[model samples]
Target chain A: MIGDSVPQGDNEAAAREVASGPVIHIRNLRKEYTSVAGVIPVLHGLNIEVMPSEFVAIMGASGSGKSTLMNILGCLDIATSGSYLLNGHDVAVLDRDTLAHLRNDLIGFVFQGFNLLPRASLLDNVALPLVYSKVSREEREARANEMLGKVGLAKYRDSQPNQISGGQQQRVAIARALVNRPQLLLADEPTGNLDSHTGNEIMNLFKELNERDGITIVLITHEVEVAAYAHRLVRLADGHIVYDGSSHEGAMSKNPTEYSAAVHSTS
Target chain B: MIGAMLNEAWVSMWANRLRTILTMLGMVIGVSAVIIMQAVGQGAQQEVQESIESMGSNLLMVLPGSSTSGGGVRMGAGALSTLTTNDAEAIEELPTVAGAAPSVSDVAQVIYGARNWSTQITGTTPSYFSVRNWDFAAGAPFTDTDLRSVTRVAILGKTVVDNLFGDENPVGKIIRIKNSPYVVLGVLSAKGQSLMGRDQDDAILIPITTVQRKLASNQVAGSVRFIMVQVKSAEAMPKAEQDIVDLLRQRHRIREGAENDFTVRNLTAMANTAAETTAVMSLMLGIIASISLLVGGIGIMNIMLVSVTERTREIGIRMAIGARSRDILLQFLLEAIIISIFGCLIGVILGIGGALAASGMTGIRVVITISSILLAFTVAAAVGVFFGWYPARQAARLRPIDALRFQ
Candidate 1:
């Protein structure tokens, strides 16, 4: 049921050989939106493979299709013409309910808005996933508390999202994401609403979680400094990858003016 | 899972306290109206039944009904009296008959001291009091000797004495009835108002022989107005009524297929008719009150829709955290149910209070039944579930992408 079941280019073998196997596999992914005007192609023939326990960042300017790619990766949307296998399950073949289960059990998402229920306590927000998983209330609370402690917000477990700072709320979101112990964590601009220092702190927490707990993370951001925290960087230009390499080399190649020109020429 | 949903529902409801309370007010008023209206209808029914019962149980009346025509001038019932004192005696001798009294009545001006009031003057034997379950409030009732002697003694009803005497004792005082002087023998107790809204105590009673001989002697001689018969028991009313009809027909020599001159009326049948009318009235009132509950349910639906729209982002966040559509539906539905349950509780208390307050103000006995409370509570809960379904479904059907992006 993995995307590898479909014949892909030679890059599949190279990606599989990097580790035991890749946690996220997408080949020739395409997405098109239809409105009253006509069909607008957003993502076109893009390929991305993420290995287990790796911290990867996707960087692109506006209209470069990075958000669309992140939505597909998070199982919130489906590819129009492509194969996406999330932890060995083919995304396109799953129904809506099964896709929800896949997202719940295998993937956790963090948003730039830090999408936590405004009236819920930090503990309740973190324990929500386990409630859907049918976990006992005591165990759910225990695990939620443990995750909060990991993020150093255990004392603020009873605090509501509005009562906390944006950085603290983002941290609570991180705790909630990790509470289920999902294999893949998807964050779309996790630090977009934070100051530079708080953004650095959030990135460092991600780095620590990746190194200490071996949790795979895929983050999407347009800021180079934010992307710098990732071990690997994948840059998108007009719905196609322009560079996929080490963060330092990718940063060196990411010239804003040149990238915008290249993006315009492609569209 | 349900417990968790309920917790979430309660939390969400508490988040907007004013809106929840305002929404619940409709249900509260609706439930209370239902109970108060039902009580009023039931109380009216009871009042009618009691008034009929006070007239006396197992009682029957024989009336002269056959009209007479001479030269195309038809005389109505009692224009020519077909009922006589002998018919009353014959009815009393029947096996099921308890007692009978021959009665005649006329509207006359009564005079005592400087006061004069126009009231009904009923002339009957002493047995009329027992037959109608009436008792003397002061002095004593006139006996058979008074009837045989054609004594000018009268029994005054409470209202008649109050109007003519103004709280003064009337027993043994001389009064004028239709210009004929008579002594008040005793005062009858108050019987309140009849079901027809007429005053029952605005009358006086004297011997039938006196009325026939002195007052209405020119109209019909030795004839009576009607016969009041009391049966031994409630079970004997029908048999006694039939016996009276048969004996009267035979005595009048009413041949086969010939119309009888007398009519028999059973108090028991009249009582049943009154009871049936009351039952139907209460049922109708209950149905009308329930419509207000339906309107209250619609109010719930309206507020729930607004809540679902306001909490779109919250729903998306929960869905992102792995909450299914059913989970979202259940949460909102539970919130509605909690509101309705609390509303119903407060409504029940207020309804009973309102009923008692009405009873106090109107001097009517309002009955609050357990079945009504249960039915009202159950309907309230059902309304919550029914109205909550559509809005909850709308919330559940929201796409996570759209809801999360909602402003």
Candidate 2:
């Protein structure tokens, strides 16, 4: 860990006792899509940082580049320009396989679809990340069971994804993500497909994980209700962040336009 | 990590058990076909080799002549008495000529205790047994003293002994040939059948003088049928043939401008032609086996490609969850290899059963070797891996974002 290399603002120090260095450091990050039609630019000149254990949400409309940013943060894709440093390792310098290990070791991802391998049991799905990390079966099972117990799905470890409820599937996916004990959890619309009640439960589990285990979480969503679950919110419009501040203001009202206009003017 | 990949593959394959077994059919047939054909081909090859050995090695047969032309009248070969006992003796004296046996034969009714059978009766010296590499099932061959004294001793072949004596041993038994009593000296061990399908084991052998004077007395003085000459080694066969021909020509008082009165044929060469034909058949079996394997490989490739396409999203999920590209490749390839190996196991069992059944039904000697089983296994596995590689690579190359976005 990069100890004390972070330049602390007095207000930040006052906010939380300068938790080791920032878990994520980004500078001028940009992404582009190339097709036969033409080159399409998505993210343009983005800079952000997330401290360890910080609960942040990246909110955006479709094609607003929040998913692209989340992808970069999860090491699924690299920025076309600019640089990213996750846990003090330069993201751009590592090769594809090394970046995969980085993803396995440092970050965990939760997708909107809850992509658990359907043929695998919940226990196997939860232990899958440890397989890539080459963890022994007994140890992987123990850690996976512990994570499942933490997510309140230990008894359903033998169930298949289809056999479980949508909320239980999401919980299994969360257990899989946390099974590797990654420092940063990047979730892309973690509750996008769920009913409101199940979505709130998943959000509460994320909240509890962040608060109790000090796990850094960066979530992507368009819904204000989901974004409100995080302590901090970063809103993207067109390819730039329009707001980066308290989630309370971002989700102060259920009306989408009130939060959007306020974020546009306030940031 | 590899264990995990295998586990994942097993789970996936188990979920699609019917598809897995159906896909294995191609491989099973491929491996089994090769094994069966090889068993049959090698069986035929072994039969030919054994027949060749039984016929004796390094042999050259000096027939009487090549379609005799005498007094402006063409006649079949051996119509003239071109070979004699003296010629056989002279050929045997040559450095490369290991042994020589001149024979006179005739068909006659043989009888013992009211049991009668018609069989070919041959007369030759004890050297004929050596020249033919003949072994006795019982008793012994007549010696030089029997040949000199013109004793009526006979060695019965398996078929002859079986007809004459039934379950009784024929050694030291007396049977009448042409109403003359001849003692049974020994029984020749069975040689099954010749390449020409002749029952070589159906004849009886006696001394040349005894047979010529008593049973088949129409021949001219000192004249005989073809001379069977055995050479010292295979490499000396050509030279031995030349020596036999030159000695015969000189002994016949034939002039330099005259055509020779005898013809020499390389018996081993003729046998080798049969062997070469068998080899070609074995080669054909090998080619067909390889073609089946190739077809099986294509089947594997096709199924793997379909599976990859159907499970593209699964691949994407694994990639997003931190599985490497090599991990995906290894999983697919491992699945193919395991299926191929299992298929080979089943095919081997089936092939062995098929071979035994074929042997039991057809009565041809069937040979199933470990090397044959190993060959089928190694080649089929290689084909599976070779064909499985491209599809696995296709799965591995899909970009995570694009793959994850696949509907």
Candidate 3:
């Protein structure tokens, strides 16, 4: 009984290594917007990859093209140039219906504003995506309740978004993102609107989700403190990747003097 | 999906209760007005038709003049006194004729003690009561003996009885008609006013011999002023009229194609003319009411456009959540339609109530046909669809990114 429960660690590890390959693959993706001021280039040929079970953060200033890249990865917008292979499928070549299906089936989004419908209950907010997929009401309710339970919000399922605190709303948003059990979670500035303490708590929750449930998380933020929590950090400036490495290594290489000085200064 | 859309529409409408009610007000009033107006018009027409028919369907009235006469001047093609007892007898002998009565009318002031009432005095034969569908409430009609003896016995109408006798019976009582004392032998039953505002029971009836002897003796020649004829049935009216015309023409020694001295009109022709007039009135009212409905539809469209602008972000979110353009279009269009249909329903109820109230107040009979209600409601719904389409399509065609970015 013990052997069956353990399930042969070596084989399991080998299967995990093969199954946890790159879930998001981006190669020289570009996006441009035409305005009255002529064409504005937002994302200038950016390349990146996100593996399963990896928690990565893309850090940039405002208008640094992080949002454009996130939108393309989430299938909310299409890239004007290059290929985006999400979950082993080329999203650039897919039709609108296929892209929508991919977004519904493979990716879940959590916005900075927590984008819960103000008129709907927390449970209903979580179930909206499932509604678009034509899921049965009974199944949707069951799944939504289950997800709310996971986020410690089972009692607050009937409460509206306005009734909850900022942290609680974000928790509900995270639960909504995980309702379909998608391969990738794209959270854009998830804790940008929260206080420092609540932001830290939310970051810890994300770390716990990555470690315990092995869900791949890609978050975009401008805050250095928030980006430090991810396993990998990709820094961008002027729509180009200035640095991409382990969080500690990127911090050290980008500003070694500040990193050591902060350590020393704090002590 | 439809149920969900309806639920969404209902919730949203109630969410903004004041706006919803205001929007529906136009439809309600428009619908109610249409129904009430139609009811009142139809009731008036019905009342006119009923009065005309009750006068006797086959009866013909031989007025002394033609309608085409210029300047309202009296012109006698002949003496106009050619309508006589002999002519009445000749008409009565026709195979299609049921009865014929010669009549002459004069306005008089009758004094009963201190109360003097002005009323019409009509001298007519015994067949007049049957031909004009008059029923006596008390006493009895004059007999042939009264006509032969020129007896001063009279039949008072309901109004005359009320004025002259109060609560007491007027039968066997004498009232002075222009200084001549006449006994009231009978009182006619109540006949309501006609559509033209004529009081049907505001006169007194006397024997033709009495009027010729006592009141209008100076104006008399060998004939009465007019002859009233009743045919056996409505189907035989035309034949009866033609036969009377032929008999009168032969009696007066008129040439072929010569215009007769009098004009005869049957109850059917009168009823048909009244119906035509009412139809025109109703058509005009309907056109006016339809214009109001159109205005209400335009109001709906204006409000829907405002709603689209206000809910731009929500629309974007829905589109981003994988809603197709058609889905968005249907949602908003359904919202507009739902509002319009609700307004129409309320309007229909109000309209029916108003019509009933008007009918009750005016003593008229209103017929509310199912087709009218269906027509009004269908028009309202179509107005919703027609007006709401542009705004809904505009909302649907908006790019998700642009809508989301809209402040």
Q: Give the winner by DockQ.
A: 2
Any residue pairs clashing in model 2, and if so which? none
Considering DockQ, which of the candidate structures 1 and 2 is the better prediction for this target?
2
Q: Individual DockQ of the candidates?
A: 0.48, 0.63, 0.24
Model 1 chain A — which ten-residue stretch has the worst lDDT?
A3-12
Q: Report lDDT per candidate.
A: 0.85, 0.86, 0.80
**Cα deviation in Å at residue B380, candidate 3?**
2.8
Runs off by more than 4 Å, candidate 2: A1-19, A252-267, B67-73
Instruction: Tell me which residue pairs clash in candidate 3.
Output: B32-B351
- TM-scores for all candidates: the values are 0.81, 0.92, 0.81
Q: Model 3 over residues B1-407: C-alpha lDDT tens digits?
A: 55555666776777778887887887777777777767766766777777775576577876554323577766753345657777887888999998998888789999887788999999888998898887889999997789889999899999988888899888888999999999989998887776467887899999988888788856655468888898998789888889988888888787999777776877667777887898788878888888888888888888889989988887766666656567779989998898899999999999998888877887677878888888889989999999999999999888766776677
Tens digit of per-residue lDDT, candidate 1, span B1-407: 77778888888888888988988988998898888878888788878877786687788888897665676765666565888988888888899988899999889998987899999988898889998888789999999999999999999999999899987888889999888899999998888777677888998999998988887745477678888899999887777878888899899898999777878888667777877888898888889889988888899999999999999988887777777788888888888899888888888889899999989998877888888889889999999999999999999898877777788
The local distance difference test score of model 3 is 0.80
Candidate 2, residues A9-108: lDDT per residue as tens digits?
2323422443477889988888999989999999987878899999999988899998888888888788999889887767788766766776776778
Stronger candidate by DockQ (2 vs 3): 2
Cα lDDT for residue B372, model 2?
94
How is the predicted docking of candidate 1 categorized under the CAPRI scheme? acceptable
Error of 1 at B183 (Å): 12
Task: Tell me the tens digit of each residue's lDDT in model 1 across A1-267.
Answer: 443232223223423443467899887889999999999998987777888999999999999999989888988778899888777678898765666666677778899999998888999999998888777899999999999999999999999999989999999999999998888899999999999999999999999999999989999998989898899988887887777778877876655323323333433
User: Considering DockQ, where higher is better, how would the candidates rank from best to worst?
Assistant: 2, 1, 3
Candidate 1 regions with alpha-carbon error over 4 angstroms: A1-21, A91-98, A255-267, B1-3, B56-60, B66-80, B91-101, B106-193, B199-221, B229-273
lDDT of 2: 0.86
- Output the lDDT of residue B157, model 3: 92
